[model samples]
Target: MEKTAFYTVKQIPPEETYPVRHPVLRTGLPLATCEFDGDDAPTTFHIGVYIEGKLAGVVTILENAHSRFDEERQFQLRGMAVLEEFQKQGLGQVLVREAEKEVERRGGYFMWMNARKVAVRFYEKLGYIIDGDEFIIETVGPHYVMCKKWK
Candidate 1:
């Protein structure tokens, strides 16, 4: 791995996220798991972090509301993943920050996610708080509802 890795975050089309998401997030699961609802909506945006011109990470921001949050201006962070080789390089952080900025740009003040248990600490480090009881997502195992709000 190079110490000075070059990476850029850019908004990408929803379909372009399948490759990274399927390998990083959905592994044994069906490829369909990577296709999320609202993914192709006009208000929804997908972001990919490209390193050395290869897609290394991806995150989708949907202008959708979570029932738990009563706020009207809210967005959901879905299918956030980084390639195994790309993990721990702070690319995940960059993806989330870029997604949050998009939410903020659209007048959204709240962002929430069904964060995998293993990634809770990662999201926590980025200022997201666990919002409710932990639960299982069947094939996906345990997850927690985490949220970050900004004015």
Candidate 2:
């Protein structure tokens, strides 16, 4: 058991973040899109938790989402997960809050993310709105585009 500290994904050594990437993609589902050139900047925004200096969890922020109705700048939340050993300890909330703070710091007014259908209630509890009908994203599963305004 260890205490958690916040970190900018970019601040962590790339190698540490890499291990959590695939695991988050697998667990987050439908909301986790395929790695389209995983190294691309627009495809990711990152935050994490470290316990005793070990990377314990990660969350990502994405911008410019694709919409059937309109194309506009929208911040997307992705890759949100805590290591198995870290679950249910409130670290997930910490990661999300920090990510939101970073988005605001970056001049981002709107935050968007595809929440897994199962996790829709979770985002809703956090003030996210579900948009469009359910859709299946390739390499991922089924999810809806969810967004929230940063106040």
Best by TM-score: 1
Model 1 clash pairs are: none
- 23-74, model 2: which lDDT tens digit per residue? 6566554323334334357445566687666677877676665564243556
Per-model TM-score versus the true fold:
0.94, 0.74
Q: Which candidate leads the pack in lDDT? A: 1
- Cα error, candidate 2, residue 130 (Å): 0.8
- Residue pairs of candidate 2 with colliding backbone atoms: 30-141, 62-76, 75-112, 76-112
Badly placed stretches (over 4 Å) of model 2 are 1-10, 13-15, 27-38, 42-44, 68-72
Superposition TM-score, candidate 2 onto the true structure: 0.74
Candidate 1: list runs displaced more than 4 Å: 1-5
The residue-by-residue lDDT of candidate 1 on 29-58, one tens digit each, is 888888998998999999999988898999
